[model samples]
Target: MACVVALLAAGCSAHATEAGPEITAGPDGVSISIPVQVTVGGMPAGDQVRVWARTYDRRGQLWESSGEFVTDGVGRVDVSTAPSTGGTYTGVDPHGLFWSMRLPENEQAPYPLMDADDVVVLLGVDRAGTTVARTTLRRVVREPAGQVLPIAEAGLVGDLYLPPGAGMWPGVLLLGGAEGGRPDPAYAALLASQGYVVFGLAYFGVPGLPTTLARIPLEYGLSAARWLAERPEVSGDRIGVVGTAKGAEYGLVLASTEPSRFAAVVAHVPSDLVWPGLGGPAGTQTSSWTRGGADVPFLRSLPARGASSAAPNQAIRSADAYERAVATASRWRLAVARIPVEQITAPVLFTSGDADGMWPSTAQAQRALETITEAGNPYGSALLDFPGAGHLVGGVPDLPTTRTAIPYGPVTIESGGDPATTAAAVRNTFSATVELLRKAMPRGRG
Candidate 1:
């Protein structure tokens, strides 16, 4: 370690100032462990690291528990990202491990790895990674309290999060943002922190899964809610879904359609109308794709106009393809899910980003959300937009690795803040949302 390396501040932002770290993948057959040596210039920081790593199969079904582990000295740790099965092993280590699920390979959804993935390490905050408070996660990731009873339907492959202790805890199904692809522990950590048993499961991953909007279904989400309620530790009847981005539409689907499953929801950066998908640019100004940042330019690498052009292709259908696919399930686009805002039966807290540039339904989502409140539906609806947030929970500025903005937003950011901070805020918001539900539907609780 160099005695003198530059650092930004004791605190960190998404933008990092390091030359990026090295993530080396292990051997072939077995799921490889990628060693991550985390540092902040001159500072040593492995003692304060927490790791959460998960990889999904080809059908978008999440394969395993994202390991939430601690690091050794030298501020380094290994996250096991590859599934036990065969495939290319591409693992990732999150900042807090609370939210470090980046889409790997040519994968928009996560998958098991057999070969090694081309690794790129992006630096954010410039400060050393924080060691998780030993008891911090134990407070949430423990066994359910009381006895976990069976709900109406606790079927196979359901994604669920259970909070510390149990019995009638506020519960929610966490939708992992748009595309339902990224690893979003933020929502789970947040809601669970606030005594909400939250299951933030992956819906899209693997190779054969139907990732398109038209083919996506809410049956999985519905069942998860019902199953959570049945848990002896859970007040399943009080279940809610916290949907973000495209997941917001799913949240609406649960609350409006399966009104019984979800008691209420706090949708962050939600889409009023579901389309193919929408997301913020992978602003990597400070990092380099050529070096070790995000490898795929994807849409994020395109100019704002080019990136924004996808809006017209909402259903992921071109003029001709739309006409062709319209006859089949692929084009009917369940993505354009109808919430019937006029008759919305569940309580909802709708949040959007003021600075998000990704939206095929930017105008439409705002209007559709507004229409619900205007209708005076029995449901409770409130909209909150971050001061300058893009699509993420942290209110960090929109910048790539090399061109990150010096943030001016409050430390308690509304948009994309750091992962732990984002989790904390979400937890607080979930607590408030639970209170609102308790008021609206007394029986909704245990």
Candidate 2:
């Protein structure tokens, strides 16, 4: 919480004593939470001062947040405890969470600031939108230290990121969701920089692979892990898998099928039951994966609910629609679709958003925890539930808190969540995941 601000009057003749805000680091010492405090001297005592922050991602996309505060008797404002009545959202919680990494109301694309090198710009403006003062705060972690390379082997296509060092590192097999293409390398790069040999695995939708998610082979994931383990920079016996959304379902099934290959498992927005594979026709229900050439058991899709005529708001991904879909499915969806958590020998960590628009991830995570508890496994498992967040969790840090309408096959789906809460959940879960991996698969143990 070290102050990093310089005080200077912008357009006003006021003498301001500006001490920059404190950027608090989460447990992993990479992600950050801000508690801002601004003080101004010799200004109109009750005038309003607007506080805002701006930063850019590696791709040069801008991210920003702004809130207005009324000066106190001495002309000072505290963002850590102020009641936010305007800006991107309205709330009473202090800490400026409302403005941090939030997606603008009409914005179609929101790129988050990732990595420690990306600086956070802080600004103070008058009620007239004139700048009163400004400063910059550095992120917690240092620049990522890793080497990224493209790799295609045994039908797996993606990138590999190795931490900068000589000895073998613990390996992590990274998988993205049903987005059909190579997984984003940013996450793998970040984890590799933090100390791992991360292989961003793409099983389908790339060259030499199936174009859609229909009946893909689970063996591909297993082969990728085996290949990663065989690498000179990776520890074969100390390996883990990190998966999101659809990828999480694959991770659970894969870990269950090959228990000895993994020492740790991190599944975000996970499912306890097998789901029908996506990337098929809009409403078509079919097996998403297979093993030994046989289709895996999967839940059937219920009739989809049309968009509400009252609201006609396509931007809001209807949680009710997804909930109804799951509810109307046959009872077999629960019995036959259940993941075999009892077979997984590795320690497990599951994170979910309670307000996820895509599916009932929170409930599924709870069921998985219950099933694992019943199994009485000595390895143990844990779940992190985030309130007011959506299905998107765990990936590159500083991405938009919300996606308005991202394409989900033939339909453009919106992820529902409180932007601030979603951002915080992602960051905290990432740090927790790193800690879990280090403990379960400590360096040099393999």
Candidate 3:
């Protein structure tokens, strides 16, 4: 069988002669933030065909997935919409192969990490244990039209993503969770591709910054926002903040304290109450945030009751600890630790997963929404809750989600949620986030 492969800027397509099967995938290359269409043809009707996907992460570790499906009456299968009869994932999910990818049993990495801006996936089709057709898909986190610039001045460390051919654009201060050391630019670049000036800031865990989350000043975020607003390409009046986990807590505090600076806020797996910082010495209490050189009141974390230690590989469910902490906190502590959502002027968007293992994000998010409603804030707020998703609900959509537990120091951390539900949550959360930002901080505004 003669096979021809054609590559395009966005993705690749392949075709085989009547003697063999054919595979087709398009736009040639695509943003990792979106889904791709994949179809296989020329197989015998009702015959089993195995479709496989493989990609090398930034660390050169291979991640792969495969599914077996019976062709339709027309001898074709649309992988995008077809239900996998048996494989790494079941049901019909357009991006199932991507999210269900897994590393080889011998591989040591906890999960596939796309450290680079893009990755190339090799997709193959096989029949009767023989390969028939193959193609390649290029997934990118950053589009060619976007540019990334590192920021180190003004006592700040971050990367700024500039949209293509920009007039004044809405600005977004992007913040990450406890992993710290400058947020990854992948999501910011994707946002930049959508015409926003995104600054991925790092408050700690990097040089010239705090080595840990303890006592990080809230003013630091304000300073970063001010710097972002002052950018010539940024519309000062249309600036917003997007943060996840601990960063979400920080963003909420910033939005509440300096309501005039931010027009929109997107918090993912957020905490309604401030929590203590990490990386401090044992038995020491330190606030994760501060303002005007004073530590902010924060809910203290309690020790895990050995429940999480029962999991294999010493993977701990951090949510249990958080739940205990909240349940046992003094009334004064609860009152003081709760974020003053009423003080926020911008419309807020909170996304949480009910099954999040890192913390009780769903309950906290609901509490925040209730507070917003009670405060009668002129700018309204919204929440997007996913039933079974985990703390990894935020970020560029359509990436691998198979690894719900990841290594954290000597032990593993259970993030909760299965791959399919988490993938769905991530996509929906991303859509809602973009919608909120566009509506609250419309472009072309001076």
Candidate 4:
């Protein structure tokens, strides 16, 4: 056995020793979405050892996860397959440490509004409250060979990610949710590393865009699509759009209105009808979108029933409000507010969670699918409805899923779903989306 010396800062002697515990991490580095295999050895047989991880989030704040496990007969703990007895997460999970990370006690931090940069995680092995071994792991968002270019021309705001060694890659217009800012590029960077030209667009809440979600012009989305298609690095004919929540709603509307533009569509926690905008003035009712200088018809959110006793920071589920509005909407209003998904010419993939606390995404996705089917649309469409999962249904796989409710502007929004199930749904949905994109929009080498 090779002698391994613990860091002097960890209160260990400088001299190398073979008797102490040792941690080994494989692949040294990987994309943020990939999992790393971790094993701790050289410990007392059947003894309890704690494996802890520490990393800084995009905001440079500390985030961490730890698990206590009993070593095997041979004094080995394989984190990749071991069932965590207690700590930040429970059950057997390969990416538990990554997805179960949380802020330190009583530390209040805002939810990250931007994509995380490369993450460096420090892993330590604690035996009887003493650090015995440590190692480092690198998680990257973009490949070294890739390039990111900011787009602010033609009334579009976004970041275009070019794949490494690409000829002309399939283009993807990535959109964010009701948060209304530049779409986080973490997912786009990962997709770019996998050979897609992803444009992380900011439709509103920027210097050049609208200050809020109210009455935004739909033509902005179409203009962004047209600009992306014109890019030399993008295969104009093979373009797709991927959006989450309000962004999903926007993407569907765009595809429906301009059926020939998008070759593929992926909507996460999608809506079946056009709904009112957010972040507007108090007691104001306005459509979320507009086209050709006219306000698009939309369903207004019903008034909150009564004052709630929930704390300010507590997560509040808004799904009930949406359900009530839909149930009470008049036939004329429903006809006008419903998204004409049947007009979409491209293949569509809808992902939703039954437990979506933000909205009834599962029901809405089902309605959209039914609309297309009844219209006899030639293009195929499918829905991935995950039971028990919440509104946070899709994204880069293997990040922290422990927090279902997070601070959004002033109030905390409860996205629903527990950590483990939501983690699984994220992984599965991401894989399915990639598979669909590869098939529907193939990349071409330059």
Candidate 5:
């Protein structure tokens, strides 16, 4: 119907209100009565309520449902889904009525759900039986952990195939290209087969989550990581992160910025900086890298505000601004480089293609790798070189695509980065991540 979120307002809640309807939910949906009183600015309405929520996915963000849940004269509402479904659903009404739903299950917990972000059970009301109260589900999901947490937070939104008793299998977080993370990609099943729990995420697409890089938060990645650390089945100390392209940027940010959170980081065809770079003086450096060299420009552009010169979409989607964007990225990324490798104490596996078209120089990655190893961090760090792959690789000698963490290296690379091989790499990313976790575990280390 309409936005029930506005009806509730800040500091107000459907469950908290004395006159609020008694909304009951079952497996199919939520059921509530009529005369829904929605309060906004101390103003109350009888129908049509909506809220905003944040859902998460593998790559970064999930999605948000706009205008969900309605109300009736009886102050009752209903929903089509169950709270037991995955994803953390937090609702805020117009007046700021807030309520969050946490599912009882996790990704490796034998649940059929794939992503928690995917499930949206609209909350509604009868509307005095005159009109239907409607609202959108605006959601926001933050994934700080670059590894297993993505699947548990975002992947559980749908029906995924994690095996029973898979509770402690080492898990990995696989990052995708600039698009967004989806749990159903061919990789999910493959990772499950690898005997590890996985959490693929979509930090951008989730309703309340920012769809663009400008909207993404540094803490979002941190939160996911901490969630993984606190889990009982998973080896919190042993978690790992695997990233590709922009996801690689995030991986680098997470692994380097929060060194203790991850056991190791597998950065596939990765570049270091976070934003586009301008050439070095007419400028030569064009991108963020293997994590080094170049003076990364400060991306002061409030592009996410739809105002700046470096809007995430403009810098990423519109090639018209490629030259300008690269100049800007150069400034922002170099600054990020100064963040200290000591801070990134985790071991790192940097994979890159000598022939990548995505960047102006492959040498930057080489340098970044050197920096990672030279930092003398407590973890292992190595740069895996593939022959012909580009920014994303794991396939043949021709145009190296991807092979991030799940192995299958040159063989899979040789198959034109075959789906089977790609899938294998995805699984291997998780498996190796789990192995990394095991190795990091105090007992495993001893």
Candidate 6:
């Protein structure tokens, strides 16, 4: 029951090696969002065992899980939950180290888990950390039971993944941030595996879409929502949106403006108020979005370059950007850019990283929480803030959490965050998001 996850160098004893272990996972195949039950059996009764797993991402970055747990009277352990005898967390925790593993950060290979079918090796050991048994699990890159259709009509360029069952499924509009190419299919596929019809939506940075994250019309998002609701395979009353970063800003606006169309929203690394266009230096600010040919008034963040002094807006790569953004709270709260949280009748789940270098996501989330409370929103709101985690907070948490100095368009932006904390944040947000969606959009499954 005293499970510890820190590095340890202990020896195994012969008495603790009576039988090897057998590991198994449920709901079929390695997937995300929905619960994947992992269980271990064939261990010595009334004893502890260490669980370990390793998987290499597409770019060859390694992700792992190492934790300790006690066996039941019949010699079994469920990795999805803490053992009754010992562990750092409790009560069906999906974010425990046993479930969501972490890998060391590699500056060279910052992206992980973007590819399909990454094989993961799971091992069970004794108290001394001696490898007693091992098995392999394939993280299914795509749901075999789902169908993906190309969506190019109505100026929307993306893929729509539908679960296999004939029953009307809850629909989710998934949006990525400014680093757009195609809406991430890996994330959308995983969500589809969990019985939801997910549309990997691309509003910009794709063929037939804008080349930059500038002056996007909010009606595009509204159209996507309406399209998702109209689909025969989707539950019209149970459609929602899942967005991160700039996409999160759009989601908040969409939920507020089209409250009746959405049942829930999950905004990962969200802002409390709309922000100005992402291109260019300070003073030459522009709107990031528009509606009906009019600009959606947005607040401005300090430019990363071209300022007389870099102290105010140069936090793009600063280690203390998270702290500084919160410190300057009074300045960013422009009444013109404030999103009407009260207007959103659907419940919202906001996830932020406290150490985010790109922007003040935590502070903005706090402002959102306050706004929701002040408005007395009947549907309510929730925030998941991770300390030491950086700007790369959303998407699937299974990806690498290394700092990437990649060129996002013409500018090179730093995606800051530590490996361990970012992994934890991903797990926390993913689980919470699924729960929020399920609660908000409850439809019968066939």
Write the residue-wise lDDT of candidate 1 on 300-331 in tens digits: 11222232344332212111221223234332
Model 5, 270-290: lDDT tens digits are: 655455432123223333332
Q: Estimate each model's TM-score.
A: 0.47, 0.82, 0.93, 0.93, 0.45, 0.73
lDDT (tens digit, per residue) of candidate 2 on 172-270: 998878776766555666677778988988878888888888788889888998888888888656589999888899999999999999889999998
- For residues 78-159, write the lDDT of model 6, one tens digit per residue: 8766543333233444445433454553324433246434345454455565776666655565767678898899778888
lDDT for each residue of candidate 3 in 226-284, tens digit (9 for 90 to 100): 99999999986658999999999999999988989999999999999999988789789
Candidate 2 ranges with C-alpha deviation above 4 Å: 1-46, 57-61, 71-78, 89-106, 110-124, 137-144, 281-284, 307-333, 396-398
TM-score of 4: 0.93
Return the TM-score for candidate 2, rounded to 2 decimals: 0.82
Off by over 4 Å in 3: 1-19, 106-112, 307-312
- Give candidate 5 regions above 4 Å deviation: 1-167, 276-339, 394-446
Clashes of each: 49, 3, 5, 1, 136, 2
Clashes by residue pair, model 3: 10-28, 10-29, 11-28, 11-29, 12-28
Model 3 accuracy (lDDT, Cα): 0.85
Candidate 6: residue 58 Cα off by (Å): 3.3
lDDT of each candidate versus the true structure: 0.41, 0.71, 0.85, 0.85, 0.41, 0.71
- RMSD to the true structure for each prediction, in A, is 17.2, 6.2, 5.1, 3.9, 19.2, 8.6
Give the poorly placed runs of model 4, Cα more than 4 Å off: 1-19, 113-116, 304-310
Order of all candidates by TM-score, from best down to worst? 3, 4, 2, 6, 1, 5
